[model samples]
Target: MSEISNNDDIRTILLPSAPFGIPEVTANDAEGTWGLRRLGVPHPDVYAMADIVSCTVRELECEGTAGPAVGEARGMELLGEVLKNPGKVARANKYKGGAYCGGVYLEVTLRDPTADKLIIPVWGRELKRGSMAYRQVIESAETVKAAFDEMIEGGSRG
Candidate 1:
């Protein structure tokens, strides 16, 4: 894992690159979130892991301190949730957003154990619309799911 320190002193953890050309996974200590994307890709589609606790708190109109420990706890909770249904949980919790800078076409699919898979439609003015983009999305999702599986099995967070 590689670490990057921002001006705010938040350390961004770039997890090991996914196998088979999938984008790398990034974990943020401040926001308690993770995402899959190619570095330096401008306005790329957002393929992010969701933290239900944080989402729920936001939805119910709440806030909290942006501390490292808080983020660590949230990350642990997210891991636990993913452990429930590694395959389906990651797909369900994955957040997809458009490539546009200002106007994002976001699509979030809820968790459904019976569903085969969640399809995230890419949208953005600058998005490269082709087989490559489509394949990247699919591969990134699968990589994330696999990462969750490995993390749960190994009892580690990455």
Candidate 2:
């Protein structure tokens, strides 16, 4: 196979904005150029390429969090139910030493033109895990819905 390029053919899965950009992810594959912008702190203890099914999602392993991955799964499950077309979610692989790390990632096959209608919402919170004015909030379908609702209702404040 040819090496992934920085072009549209590369599958750049767009995932929920990472909290505080602690665990930033980038990709250059058949889907296009994808990136996960983290919005918080608490740098990950470990970072690696995760093979979920046949696609790859960035695995962010942080210390002090235990359920981002699970929360993301539940949220995606809820979102899929709401959308009526189960969408795949990227999660941190605990089996690969990511137990303490909460994760967020993009699906490799989210490149179909029609799939553009599936919009992944974004949000923010007080930074947690440090002495700052931010906090780490769980990334779930509900959070995305709430965040999108807030954005549609009246944009963001922080």
Candidate 3:
């Protein structure tokens, strides 16, 4: 794990690697950008990505939207798809937007058209408290990793 600080307002965490050669996850408090990246690479190679604005989580939860739950489910589904067949996902590129998932948006895009590299970008509003968003992002990233681990160990889809 690593901590990156650009200024007083911005704080970023480089999370541990996910199971099965998955890319590294990152969470930035200030910009509300968080997701997976293949580090030690030259270009911008984000395998999976997500962002959230301040107070978005609280609002969704308060409004009885179950935003976090929905987000996790969708994230897991996308991750499974990516793991199973990245090339198919890259060619289809159908995962995007989250209006149906109660504001927890997930977008899958081909970062490099020449290569089969894809990036999954999820977006929600944000959390209110300091570091809440950061923590939540970490939680989400960890959840993905754990699920992936479970799938690997148990031979089941997580």
Candidate 4:
């Protein structure tokens, strides 16, 4: 086997980034194209990309009403439905106290015609409603939207 060194297949692009917008700007605030932000004051709640990541749902087998084909559905899609409509929650025992107990997550499924199913996990800050986990009342789905935006704009990189 010989060397496969090629630079043509690689490229770079520059995007505008700033600490913060005028109105939102504080003495030490910032924001990146990827939804990264450093805010001035603490508002009720604002969503932003918590941690950017993605994966795929591989084929599997099982049994149930939705009966048994792992690859048939995308994990990301399931995550979305879970978040869109909060239900069936499990506590995070390992983590600290009551607050972190019943946390929620969103899985966004993404894929191309010939590409494998891409599953993206979106995490959010939720408010505890009795025993249920709900997004912070003041929180918007901005984080979910931002993450998806990154996937769309970043493409393979996302």
Candidate 5:
């Protein structure tokens, strides 16, 4: 076989001293999973948002930083709690709220080892990895920390 063809080139980009780049690349993160994974992402884009979520979680600590929620909630219920009355929105299937000015039609399925996954539906920030919008999303320490604290903590049955 011919030498394995290598075409991928490694390049580094430097920002032009602007206040973070913008949503130059856009994709619908319907579940916010892709955005959340950046919390643990290993990309070295330098501009990559690996710690976007985790960093905010740490910064948003209260006097007594709590753990994840030790309970379960459906998508609608979680949305209602955040929205303070889903009104007619709760009964809907698809949430396209994020489309309104960088908002995300956020849906999250949380899991506990001893419990099932909790589906949370909320209208929150839309995070695009390496985008300034994502940078702003993580700036709110309270929101991130609260999300972390509300996570359900489960114990192994072993």
Candidate 6:
């Protein structure tokens, strides 16, 4: 009898970090699935759903806050509405000069049943003078919300 061995190289995925030693998300999420599972994605699908919902809310708030020009407080009222809800699983915060002359930072989070947390951020900077700051904000919010609705309802099922 002859002895034989199988050799193979294992591959691993690398994820990008946010900043300042904050852990990053590296998992490859399956389409239409959420959370980690040995066989596949786990139950409840909170992470994915949270992402959709948070993004939707952010867009709505941004639109509300945006105005005709930079430094205008057009969307502040809408921003307030989005901030009403916050907890461990999901939240949105306004970052005030935390780093890099930080302006308005919108953050959304989702905690999976497995204790894994997913955080998404929409960083905003006041537009230049006469720039399309308000228009951009409103457009971006609309785009994001539309995308979320499409994903949830399985793609423009009109």
What's the true lDDT of residue 39 in model 2?
Answer: 40
Instruction: Give per-residue CA lDDT, model 4, range 12-123, as digits (tens).
Output: 1111123312112111112322222223434412222222244222211112213332223468965665576433212222122333322233333333335443222222
Candidate 1 off by > 4 Å? 1-20, 38-41, 44-158
Give the C-alpha lDDT of model 4. 0.29
Model 5 TM-score on a 0 to 1 scale: 0.19
Top of the candidates by TM-score = 6
Q: RMSD for each model, in Å, please?
A: 21.2, 18.5, 18.3, 18.7, 18.1, 15.3
What ordering of candidates by TM-score runs from best to worst? 6, 1, 3, 4, 5, 2
Which 10 consecutive positions of candidate 5 have the poorest summed lDDT?
Answer: 10-19
Tens digits of per-residue lDDT for model 6, 1-158: 00112123211111122442212222222344232121223332233433433433332132223233222224875455446533311212221211122222223333334443333332344332234664554454354344444444542232
lDDT of 3 by residue, 1-158 (tens): 33434446433343333332324444434443444565455333322222111111111222323233322346679788778877655434322232222122222333345653233322244333235554665456454434333323332221
TM for every model, in the order presented, reads 0.24, 0.19, 0.23, 0.22, 0.19, 0.30
Q: 1 or 4: which has the higher TM-score?
A: 1
Candidate 1: worst 10 consecutive residues by lDDT? 53-62
How do these models rank on lDDT, best leading? 3, 1, 2, 6, 4, 5
RMSD over all Cα atoms, model 6: 15.3
Position 121, candidate 6: lDDT: 30
Error of 5 at 91 (Å): 30
Top candidate, metric lDDT: 3
User: Which residue pairs collide, candidate 5?
Assistant: 68-151, 69-150, 69-151, 69-152, 98-103, 98-104
lDDT of 5 by residue, 37-155 (tens): 12223442221222122212211122111332212346867666547744423322112322223232222233323533321212133343456754554443334334333221211
lDDT of 2 by residue, 72-107 (tens): 456567566446632222223332343332343323
The per-model lDDT (C-alpha) reads 0.35, 0.32, 0.37, 0.29, 0.27, 0.31
Candidate 1 positional error at 101, Å: 39
Q: Model 2, which residues run further than 4 Å from truth?
A: 1-19, 22-98, 106-108, 111-136, 139-142, 145-158
TM-score between model 3 and native:
0.23
What is the number of residue pairs that collide in model 6? Answer: 3
